[model samples]
Target chain A: MCRTGPSPDPPEGGETTSTDAAFTALLEDSADELYESAPCGYLSTLMDGTIAKINTTLLTWLGRSREEVVGRMRFTDLLTVGGKIYHDTHFAPLLSMQGSVSGIALDIKKAEGGRLPVLLSSVTKNDSTGRPQLIRTTVFDASDRRAYERELLRERQVAEAARTQAEEDRERLQEALAVLQQSLLPAALPPVPGMEAASHYHTASPDRLGGDFYDLFPLDGKRWAFFLGDVCGKGPQAAAVTSLTRYTLRAAALHDPDPVAALTTLNTVLHERYAAGDPRYCTAIFGVLEQAGDTVKVELASGGHPPALVMRQDGSAEYLPTPGGLLVGILPSAPFTATTTELAAGDTLLLYTDGLTEARIGEERELFGDVALRDFAADLTHTAPHEVIEAMTGLLNSFGDGLDDDTALLALGVPTDRPDTGSDSPT
Target chain B: MDIVSRNNVTVTGPQDAPVLLLAHGFGCDQNMWRLVAPALAENYRVIQFDYVGSGRSDLSAWDATRYATLDGYAQDVVEICEALDLREVSFVGHSVSSMVGVLAAAATPDRITSLIMIGPSPCYVDSPGYRGGFSAEDIDELLESLDSNYLGWSATMAPVIMGNPDRPELGEELTNSFCATDPAIARVFARATFLSDSRDDLKTVNVPTLVLECSQDVIAPREVGAYVHDVIPGSRLVTLDATGHCPQLSAPEATLAALTEFIGNQS
Candidate 1:
């Protein structure tokens, strides 16, 4: 009875049916198990965000029983407060409009007092009548992903903080350099009685501090010492040379009260300080102004500096030529020249560094030469000290980015009218 | 920088009609009004724009000092109105933009005719004897959440991070997503929007106001809407059946009905 010799292919239909029935049962059981223990958690919520059904995997991840969540808690209640707010504001509205929203990263509050990072994808399932019946959501455990992102964010914050600190340090260094540079210049030009005085120093580059300095301090016996000078190069080294030059000139002027002696003292100090290989040099003009009744007497000395301009009351400008001067701090005993000029009524004596004449102009990048300067000064013959400085500043502004060198301008004008009723101190 | 291009202003609808400026909230851009704006365009001259640092706005215009507070965003709104020469407007603001509109209207009352706040919270941090809804710790957690999400986004948004301005279509392609803000700007905006205390500005709203409160809105609750209504003089409060914070997207028809009724009644 047990099927001998192939047994007519073992009643093919009957055997096949038996195997198929067994396979069907196994497949059904496998599908059920697959859904209940899937890698991700699944949930179904009502249109109003009420939890209608949930799988075993979700309940296990939440550490809650089916009885605790279903019909008792809303889907949003399982989220942290901030996540809940974000859900209500952005997620829900997006889902309703687009019919689905996916890849939303939110945190779910555990049954205990903790949070679970999860990446949620949700879709609204509508009934046969097209009314949205429920929201079907799948949550993936994103703890590892969140940790990686947190690490990345921490690194980014660290880099950002370090970058900010570096920027602040650079800013502090720049500020210190600026204060040092300011110390090398006069806070305010000293007022010379019966003569109006104005000076301006323009920096060429903001990155590195310039080493151009100017000061007008009073000397004994109704005389005043004024100097405009430019040190070689820029930055800290040039700044040091400028500081030394300013202090030595003032001390030398106090002792001698002579323009040529003040220049010689500055030259001696620079040559002595930096004589060993790294020599420091400068171009300077030292002068003294003393009131001679209605006119002012000026004694000018030049040490490789540009010629000074004397603008007269008749709108004619001429160079107060002081030639045959050597560069300061070069040779031990450098030769120099002195020229004396008087500022009569409505006359302005302008002493400036070569930075004004060396300024680049136009597309050809040509120099704004001495001839242009003379012409500009001639046009402002009757201008007062402040007005002349203002016009010159306007001209500098018109050059735009073309003016690349530091400029120092010092002007002493004999006022056309009587002096103001204010005190002698500069405002 | 032209202010119009800086804020990515996009003007449409009837040219001669009264202005209806729709300002988007914190997390999204002007695209949030894609559905409702087209409907409102039938009657009113619809105006929409992306705030600087969001959408297609000029990123170079983002100054940390200028955009440090909500006042800066409010100033942008005023400037946009000025750029378009829009004298009178019915401002429809959703979520954080509601309060942004509040400040702008308070400052430039002559420009704004009616204020329609979908969901506004005058202050988000809770204090003694006040119910602003969230705590400081909760806000901190929100910031952390934003941080995590932004980190995730940066991986895919590499082109934007590299500052390749030539490929603007890359950003345009991701317009449908809700969280498409630049990470740095979003952090600053999150801090500014959530940490603001604008209770003092409520009484300064001189325009006719419409408060649209939704049911079960966790971001801006019913009490917050009621507080806004009570403080703002001659403000009308309507509790919508829409269940979330953004009724403009979820329940646009209802929002349109209320808006048209109010705007039509005003004329």
Candidate 2:
């Protein structure tokens, strides 16, 4: 402390040499002490990051003596392993290129295995010849900043864990819904004598349960009843309607087995079940295959469903039109129309939901309409029931994210040759 | 998919000459070959392109499902060749792109005639029988470094890095300042590139190949280069006197010499 100017008027204002001498002595004494006791830690290092000079405050922060750090350790050695790697790869290169970097957050390893979070700012000093000489650094204790960052990281981790749990729950729900959906449909189609039957149901999304369903079951004496239908919309509610529709169709067919009568019964059941706030509806086709003499007669009835396609052995396809049918469960008495078509040795009847015809064509909004379906079925005239189903399923797959709705398909074809009944004959 | 713009394909040099396709490695784009490509373009038809989500290429085309593995990058190379209708290509790949080249050759064997891998590593993380120059813990540290480094640079340079839509030189400048890419995309690519194991693919490379290993290279060490040379049947190994991972940037003449000699021998 220079007490040379403490008096009111510097009583010895004329004694200039004495005051100048005191000021000079004060500067010389305080420079080193001021640097040593600065608020922030100060250090100087060689160009290669070897520490050359360090102050008491930094040494105290690192809990190391001057002998241990100066010249014995690189500036990066004070950092933890990960921070050291970052220093080597990014920090050093950036310093060399840009000549300085500031506010770099890193964790410095203390002498006794504790960590000191710090923000470092460094500038490269060069000699008079403009060659790089040493680096001067100022490090600020960032313990509070580090704590804030860690709290932020912890909150982020908590949110991330919650998001992951939500995603897992959604996947589980999707799986459960898929299993439940599979249970609602028939496991396998019942084998009919002298006939081949194949069916496939394609759901647009693997996550949501679709409402498309189909089943082929035996009625009383020489007749087999089959129905393919799709409920409006999707998900669990639609799945409920699907289950109800499937069981009601089975029960109604067990009583009547006539195509129009069974559909009429289904329409009545659904209309009564959901006549309140939200009206439930479905487009369906009910068919029965029965043996007459030599050929099989398939009686099909439609309720706002696409007409069935009959492909003959001669490579010709035609839609057996069942006109004037309304959607099931819409009106109390939605018209259900029935039509009869004969299935000879080489005739195959194909029934499908609207997903196929309504699939988008490439990026266009235009649907894959009757023209495309006609072309697709015209080529599959000689195909068997299973082969036709396989080919149609492949076509649906070719849409490639364009088919945005669920589709159900059913194909019934008579055999080319009846099996000879010799020893086990029941005719 | 417009493969041309997706990979930012640039075709120059004599059209009828044998094609030299240059593919860059991680932390860089086609500009990594800036010094070396001009000389090669004088003699050969030079083709350069950036990977999707890299410099000047369409970031919109970066599909995680498509680029989840190196095969996706290999598919990019094959598609580039098909789009250009280039036959008899001498594929020049740097760092991780070496394995990508091998995959491309295996995919379209007739299009690519030879392979040049500079500072190549089949695997970065060490395995049971392999000395891949890094451990899983080291890779984790590297990943952390990447995260922190991106955080350090993105805050200051994001606008300059992303705003120069038409001028690609800005992107090159960003790369020079800080190896810049979209941070999220870069993280995905770093994991994909570092965690991959393509040691088995080296054996399937039926074409003539050359491995250019730099002395004192830290990213791909000498032993990893030798392993790549040993597995690739009849492939030539040339150790450049240059140092560091990017010889084309640090020692262009040495890198160019090795590349020209190899291409001449193949032709």
Candidate 3:
């Protein structure tokens, strides 16, 4: 019986004979025969890498006889030049110190011209005295593995290149958007004769182009025209509307220096250009400043825009309201409200878009509102146009993430004392 | 930067003896000298360090722009000498590091006294009237080899290469982490080692130098070794009875004998 002295015997006699025959076949395979014909190549080398003995499987892969490889060639001679260098630099040093190395990939030069990729493992065999005498190595054919690894490396390189390209493209687009956004606004405010003028613009995000724009340019030798406004939305579409509005107002003011006529011209152009299914609109304050004796006379027209604030030299602040102004570009004939004021010495007039008053503040998400802005301006000690604009800029920055929209600001004032030169000079 | 920790410097042997600075080549770290370091340490103070981006050195200290050229490696050597306040030291450099030792010696003339170059080839690519034993295509093949090896380095191999202290069984099975460099860092080092041309700097060597060449090295052949010896005036060239490029590992006894003889003669 195959069980050899078992208490219980099998019920099937046919199965026992088959099992016994299989065991007999397995036991017939000798260790020496298995070593020579193993699937992997095996070899034994001296401490200095001299090939002392090698199996027939390794010899067959090398395509050389045992006489040529054993004792005639060192282990390095079997490797490709590149693999040899890698062995000397990386593999040899590790094996010597660690006493064993596993899964090191290298290329072996075949007898005929091609190369065989292999994964090699070697272990040092020590004598009874613990002195290293021989090295036992096993080599596995890794042609398929190496080919797969090469494919992976190539894919990795391509992915890295694509990522770098995408990053560069994103940076270039941002730069181009920034340049286009700057073109919609004035480079600088022209110097107003016998007055001081200052302006600031803040964008909510760098990626999306801001729709807020402002400019102050001389209409003639005596009077200066200025406008500050915000379009309905952000990005390229709103920027286009802002550009059309800015040029229309500038051209219309040259034709007629009256504030009402300049804004009316902008209204007509915007209503006609964006008159299709998707309508575009903006809120704007167009004004004119002229030297009237010692004070500057300011006349302004608003198209559903926020009322301008006047910070007086006597520590008083109030909004010069023009009520019932219709939103521009809603109809062919939109009614705009008109107002007039005089800026005395040390008095400043500030115009801003709704972004400042509509900004969210605190945990309650409460709006900053027009009343808070008036109080903030009244608390300021300096009434100069540049000082007012600077304080307003600081207030806007303090809002931080609370300010989620584009804001534009413009300030015009009369100086306390006249300068020696009557020529136009920027503040 | 704490230069000791940054470069993974390890000092052994007598504190009062003359210092021997051992520098490893590309594709390896300070562990390359493990076999030969003990023999040299018997009389000299042995100093071994891994280059930044090579071994257990502080990888955060590695800057691509700084280490892009051989001069950056030389700066590491100079800073190590300055940090230890060492003088009259013997520099033993293997492979690409041999050129680095030349640069470090020139930068600080009084600090490094002698240079021992083992299997050094200044230029790996062959040009007009020069034999560096490798063609440009062969170097590209070497780079491809590195890339292939890196693919196998990620999952199952990383822990084995970098010792696994968590499993004591695997820990004992762990080999030296000489080649356990970050793949990106290894790519840069491979490019620097193979694509560089350092032939002109050999003439600037003023220290007593020893050019040790293996009798049969696939990387640095006899012609390249002879070229290095001929360029440097008053340099000694000894052909060791070795097989591979790393004589220190393949023939440690012969490597030690040549090094000790050279160092003893300097004294």
Candidate 4:
């Protein structure tokens, strides 16, 4: 019984071995058949580059009888000119050192003078002594792949050009907004003697800036002319009319001393340029200052412009009113009005565009309208022009992503603290 | 110019006697002239050696770049004549090598008495209205076929080129001749041999020229050979009844008769 157990196990193992032998024989037969009929070419060469053997697939590709190429032709002879260079520079050296190389592209010269692109992979075969003797190479046709790659590159270039054009458009929009902002304000505010005056203008977005501007140049010593306004429409047409109005104001100022005459000249130019058809126009404020002593004389005009805010040294502020003024360019000889005020020490004035007052406050669609700005200005009555600008900048920042349109703010101030106690101190 | 290259060569021809130098084409080497050599040896000292990369010559010394042009082969012909100090030499080159003889003769008009051009062509391309027998494209196809079937067909076609080998394995050995030199070197020769257009040199040959046009030649047909004679200066066109390219093998008796008569007339 002891011997029977071991003997029975041997026969069982022997039966499994026979089954394995049959399975292996089937695999060998299939492999031989596959090699003879494979769709792609197969070849092997000596390390010295002589073609040692080849298959029917390659023979058919060459369109030659079997007796021709093998043993007589070297592998390099079959290459086209460009293919040969790639082979020498990249393929040959790589194959030699690595003893194998793969997916190498080549063009084999056909019997008819045309060339067929192909991908080749080769491995070095070694004898029992571990010395490489032959290279067995497999070739796959690659004509379709090359065509596809060329198409992809052409499409990519077209897409890159489109992206560049879109970027150029964005830059142009920002520049237009900047020019529109400049047209709303005077190029200069008439300078006041014995009074230190300064103002700041800040942009919200370069792509679409808030239209704001400020300037201080001499109308006369101790006297100045200044105004600020905002247009209703956006983009290039609005910018053209705004440019016309700003230059017209300067020209009319040189023609007459009256601020009202300057405002009328700007309105007439805007109407002629824009009011004919598809007219665009804006709201504006104009003012003239004349100083004799501690008190300075002032005249103001508004043409559908937001109210100008004034802050005094006594911690109180109010909006100077000149209502019922129409849009400056919509009608021929568009209606414009003026206002006057006396200047005091430690006084501040602010001008702004509707882009800021009309800004959305929250998801509720609530607007930070003119009243809210008036309240904000009142809070800054005791502050200087720079302090008011900084505070306004912080308020805009707190609005986060909600400021959808352009905003322009201009602020001007007269110093409360006297460094010299000069002519403005009743001396 | 026909190129002549040699480190050392043996030239055995008479000092003052009219020299007739013979060469073979394709499969066979210079030794193919052994049958007619003894006849010429009776009067003129004959010179013969293997081609640079063929037969018994040094294969290692072959410069692929130089020997790649038929000029190198033609140069050897010119040098052999000069080396032997032969004046008024008659160079009889067969098959592709005949063009080499024409070029060599054209280079040194004084040394070559005449060129016996067997088969020559200005170009292998077929003209719009004329057939040069094979179009240039056809020749290219033949070259590609040669590349693909170089091993098997060269062996199979050897006896046809060399006629009868003393041993059966001789055909096999000649088929493997492509491997005798580096396969790359053989490639250069194959291109230089078949692609040559030597018709331009024919008219420049100042010597009295004779082109032997072989009838029924598959390699160099009779009509094409006549075209060669037409281009050459004062050349006599003779068409012999022969079957193949190597008339020396296919019609040696007829070939011998022709050579002797042509040379004897001058003598």
Candidate 2 DockQ category? Answer: incorrect
Candidate 3 lDDT over A132-186, as tens digits, reads 8899999999999989987888898899999999999999999999889888888
lDDT per residue for candidate 4 within B1-267, as digits (tens), equals 222323224456555556777765543356556556767767775656556665435554678777878888877767776665667878877667777877788776778777676655555456775445555555554443233223222334433333233564554434323223233444566677756766666667777767776675545666687777766657788788754355554356777788777777766
Summarize candidate 1's per-residue lDDT along A1-427 as a digit string, tens digits: 1323544444467778677557657766686687788899989998777899898998888999999999988898988877776677557766776777777789998887688899988999989999788999999999999888889889989999999999999999989988898889988887788889998888888777787888899997699989888898888898998999889888999999788888888888888888997899998999998999889999989999999999887668899999998889987878889989899988998888877888889999899999999988888877788888888888888888888878888888999774443332221
At residue A205, give the lDDT of candidate 4. Answer: 52
After TM-score superposition, the amount by which residue A19's alpha carbon in candidate 2 deviates from its true location, in angstroms, is 20
Q: Model 4 Cα displacement at A409 (Å)?
A: 1.5
TM-score of each: 0.74, 0.56, 0.85, 0.50
lDDT of 1 at B167: 78
Candidate number achieving the greatest DockQ relative to the actual structure: 3
Alpha-carbon deviation at B46 in model 2, angstroms? 3.6
lDDT of 2 at A264: 93
- Candidate of highest lDDT: 3
Lowest summed-lDDT stretch of 10 residues in model 2 chain A?
A: A418-427
Ranking by DockQ: 3, 1, 2, 4
- Highest TM-score scorer: 3
**lDDT of candidates 1 onward, in order:** 0.82, 0.82, 0.85, 0.64
Model 2 residue A75 lDDT?
Answer: 87
Q: Per-residue lDDT of B1-267 in model 1, one digit per residue for the tens?
A: 487777778788888888899998877667778768888888789989888877657777887877779899999999998888787899988888888898898878889888989888899888987798999888877777666655224545633532346876565445235456667787788888889998888878888889988887888899999999999989999888877677777678898898888888777
On the 0 to 100 scale, the lDDT of residue B130 in model 3 is 89
